[model samples]
Target chain A: MAHPQPPESDPQSPSAPTAPAKSPRVGLFVTCLVDMFRPSIGFATLKLLEDAGCTVVVPAAQTCCGQPAFNSGDNKDTRAIATQVIEAFEGLDYVVAPSGSCAGMIREHYPELFADDPAMAQRAQHVAKRTYELTSFLVDVLGVTKVDAAMAGTVTYHDSCSGLRELEVKVQPRRLLAGVSGLSLTELPGAEVCCGFGGTFCVKYPEISDKMVTNKAEEIVATGADTLLAGDLGCLLNMAGKLKRLGAETKVRHVAEVLAGMTDTPAIGDPAASLPNKER
Target chain B: MQSTSRNFKDNAHKALNDATLQRALLNVKSGFQENRARTVAGLPEFERLRDAGRDIKNHVLANLDFYLERFEENVTANGGHVHWCRTPAEAREKILEICKRREAKTVTKGKSMVAEEIGLNDYLEENGVEPIETDLGEYIIQLRHEPPSHIIAPAIHVTREQIAVDFRREHSDLDPNRRLEEPRDFTDEARAKLRDKYFAADVGITGANFLIAETGSTVIVTNEGNGDMTQLLGKAHVVIASLEKIVPTLEDASTILRLLARSATGQEMSVYTSFSTGPRRSEDRDGPEEFHVVLLDNGRSAMLGTEFQDMLRCIRCAACMNHCPVYEAVGGHAYGWVYPGPMGSVLTPSLIGVEEAGHLPNASTFCGRCESVCPMRIPLPKMMRHYRQREFEKGLSPQKARAGLSVWSYVATRPKLYRLATRLASGLLGRLGKVKGRLTTLPLAGGWTSVRDMPAPEGKTFHDLYRDRQAAKGGRE
Candidate 1:
């Protein structure tokens, strides 16, 4: 596949500091959760990519990453969705998503799903090799240690299960967050455990899901972090919704919003409650 | 055991509402979980040992026919009898036949899950033979007429407060006002009562942790030493085990032993590790006079070359259940069968037909923690997924769930249709939920809203916004 003529890029924000040059062109796979529930994370991802000196595009043909089907044991559909995604992003130098779950599906499970189809399996393998979660791509591929972004108050980060276990994304986000001025990170107990927002899992087993999220809520509040940030919107929504129902005042937001210095939007599930976070 | 696994949802619901059980579950964190972490960290070779353990089991499973035949020959050479049973009924019949030949009126048990699996206790009692449970946890549960909630910790769901009441009622021979408030007090009374049962029991039955083909020995590892007493004092000793427990050599058993205690209870080693080859020799004193080994296949040999073959490598460590968040919440009874937790999720379907046990495999978040902690490195989540796939393909899953998946799949495979459908659905739900920034109720989403609110979407779809942003750049991909 040949690359399309590259789009001319503009500096995203004048106040932000970035090293400018011709860089790799990336296609952002705005995951199903991000595309539906929260588009702010998608924009935040764009700003981070642009600020990091990469030309990014959004492929319109993409829909779900087929996680809901893959998880439900529908391999035939999983293969179809994966094959479509491979063709959709086949021309890009890198395919990045802000979700570890979606990124993990594409990176880890897609090739296995298409193993019987030799030609399509090779395509899935190629797409998987270049796919990455947002923060991991920035730190790993772009050599980004610090961001020209900052947020106030203490915030605890959650290691979403797929991100931590399959992709090994525990340290990259932390390493980047360490550079954000005025941000103090507290460790969450059982941070590696699932928040029980396993796509269809929360609905299928609500009592079990409630118990898991309640435990997570108590631990998040116990840290007294005042705010919670995670890489995946599915987990953030689950934790944030539970925290709200429990009458806890702890706020929740996607990690990209804080990392891109785009903290003006309201925290998730906070009912238009604005982030008091400002430039440090 | 008969399965109530079909009512898994309701059982989990009740288990969650039981406050006493909830309080007891808190101990799991400070109990097995912490101890296992500490012991594992102390041993740098734990990972290497796990590899060795997995390899030894894999080798035995590949050559299972050879090892079982060799094991039978060796046991016979050591003056023991081996019975090959194909089903649970056959196994129970064999044990009863031996008991009748010995004129056994009472049998002592030492915490065998296989006995529970075969419903051995109730079957024996129905045949006019009394079965006495000597393990403290098993004894507590036996008196309550409850099945073992967990494989290793039989009474994990029962609180000590509940046990105090049970002891006062069951042990009517004891002082009514005795200090039975502590765990040790309960243990002391149980020890006194069971010490009498040991000498009276004509047959003693215990489960095998490993069956060594080379040494003709059946091994059992226990912390309480009840297994030793059960085997030593009875006139006849019977070892009941599944077919997969056999290993080719004693050294292979030793390697797995190094991993078993630590993974199960976080101990450097269990207190009593006994190996019994056969009946007592002519010169030997204080040992059982008759020795018998019952090897029950019961659907296990059929799993030899299947996707579930890895499950046979499990040593019943209980580490998978200890770290599983779902098991941590509802306890083992909710799983509704002999085994529970991640290992049970895979094995239950294989042993007890998938139709009754399909719900067990579906009750997971696929967190991968169980596979991470398994001593044999069994791919538990993958196997559970395999069960789910079988259920789906066989049309055994619910009609609504299958139809929903098909409808969703039909759209998801068609990119243009999927994008348009999502765009319209989000546009409508986003407007309805925008005011409060979350939805308290949703169509077909009662499971989510019954406990917590659903975070609503921002009004516009991401593609609309992204296309506009890229259009302003005079480019579209």
Candidate 2:
């Protein structure tokens, strides 16, 4: 599969020879789902970036990436959301994201979204050029081939559609997973296919989404892997939701959380996890 | 083919519950998907050929009027007639007129999507001309009184048991009790049954895959040889095709043909690739005497120079449908018309207005698999999004969805309100779901939780966590 290495199509491939004189300043685009559902992924991503010598900051003004609006053909809303995002991260040297869906929207769709407005388009193009998915940034820009992380089971990876197709993050996550100690990576059949968590699509067409995830669960179970890992939490939660419903005990976590060796917390969709304190 | 396209949700619901249809769809899911991947992997030049194919179709489209005229001139010179029709009604009437002129009581047909596009079979049957389907897949669906589910495999939704029953009911003259469990058995029976219809029919009706302007030849590729027999045996041969089927030369046709079967069925070449120019010469013994072509425009001309012109490049390979998870789940009948899958989603609304077929485009997950496997590299998901945009702009989408999106857009633009709203919602939902790690159900989210549980959020947002961490590392040198 020629994975676990930067593809030749990387936007930053020309000058990968030497490390920078200063730690690169980064603005983490905490995607809406990660901000709401699983904050551990954000911490794991920040730790990995910091470990790789990045000066990371989370922009306070950041919100959604406008993917839901853009995908549903609400271009007006999409432009507004995109403008807010572009403004929030414009001062940084890099904007990295943990979810492929959000990262891909910035990297691939932002320029197109702002194409008519010349100044906004220029800023968008710059933001897109500087944007990278978390794993791809660590391996491609930071040149970190290995990580100090450990896991106990045979884990299979699901390549979320947006990341694999739009950002070409197929090999980056695989590369990081290979460095985890005591972890055997078994390739899941049809791993590159979607898990039917296409944001609004799952709820819009539940039957079709259910059928797609059901097939995905069957393939996951067939691999006999005890744990499932993927970069995007949307796909992980969708697959995890189905896996738990089907009564399979397979643990599901973001590739970042596992690769950061922070698996002490319960799996993202595990029903057995204890609730947070009410009087914080 | 009546358009129940508007009732797609209902159609899909029925299709999902039909066990027979589900079993029949398995062949399309496994056989076509696996074979196409293997064949595409073997050809390194597949992507290049897709570019070539797209360029050829684009060139023809740019000069479509010129190519059609040149093709007509060539056809006339070759002792053939070309009937240019702007609508399906005109094409059907012209075809019937020619058949009645030849006193054709029976018409043998090769598989043609344009034929389906015009609803030719029902029109002919209503006017007292018998149309006998010659393609194996088309023949099976024809006997069952159904429109084709899949374009290439017309009877993709019909099971072996259903076909056996259909044959036993229709072909009373044949042996009543022969074992019809095997696919080969069904194929043998169809071949034997359709064999006589070819010779007995007075007119042959077939669709052209490509029409060459240089030679005035109409080409059709099929795994079955019935097309050749249909054209040769009948007294008059009628080729019905859309206007976009015209190409400049034979070389362009062959270049596109290289991508055709490999994408359609993963075969290096179809069993038969027949090119007919006019009719047989005076010296020929076994060819039809009259040759005519019906060129139907329908709505293709409207698509040119629009956001949809790229769709003219489609060669009806069905690769997009074969690999689509949505199509695999509910099958082609759910799409509710002549076309299905990613290609159908884009092309249907373009042909039959988006107001009627809005759901087709929205049905996709935008998985990008269709574009990945497409032989012509059609940006299917992008076009589907275009349809959604049009539907939204026209206010054709459901009122509830529009209202929800409006509210979301309003809140999302105001970052403060968006933060406050999400924080409160997440805090309440988090506390509720923290005990269980997931939510079995939630208000207005039953569409999601009806099928699977929704994962609970962590107590704090990433922004909140990041702020806390930064405070702890305050004033770091």
Top-scoring candidate (lDDT) = 1
lDDT (Cα, tens digit) per residue for candidate 1, span B1-477: 899999999999999999999998887777999999999999999999999999999999999999999999999998999999999999999999999998999999998999988999999999989999999999999999999888899998888889989988888888877888788998999999999899999999999999999978999998899999999888899999998999899899999999998999999899989999999999897789989999999899889899899999999989999999999999999999999999999999999989999988889988888998999999998899889889878988889888998998898777678878878888987888777778888889898888898887886788878877778977544
In candidate 1, which residue pairs clash?
A: none
TM-score of 1: 0.95
Quote fnat for model 1. 0.66
In the range B1-477, model 2's lDDT, one tens digit per residue, is 578789888888888888888888789767998888788889999889999998999899899999999999999998999999999999999999999999889999999999999999999999999999999889988888889988899988888888889999998887977889998998899999888888899999999899999999999999989889988899999999998888899999999999999999999789999999998888877788999999999999999999899888888899999888889889988898889999999999999989889999999888898988887778999899989888888888889988999999898888778888878877888888887788888899998889888888876777666667777888231
Candidate 2 lDDT over residue span A49-79, tens digit each: 8777666768778789998888788888899
TM-score for the A chain of candidate 1: 0.90
For model 2, the superposed segments whose C-alpha errors exceed 4 Å read A1-20, A271-280, B475-477
* Count of residue pairs whose backbone atoms collide, per candidate: 0, 0
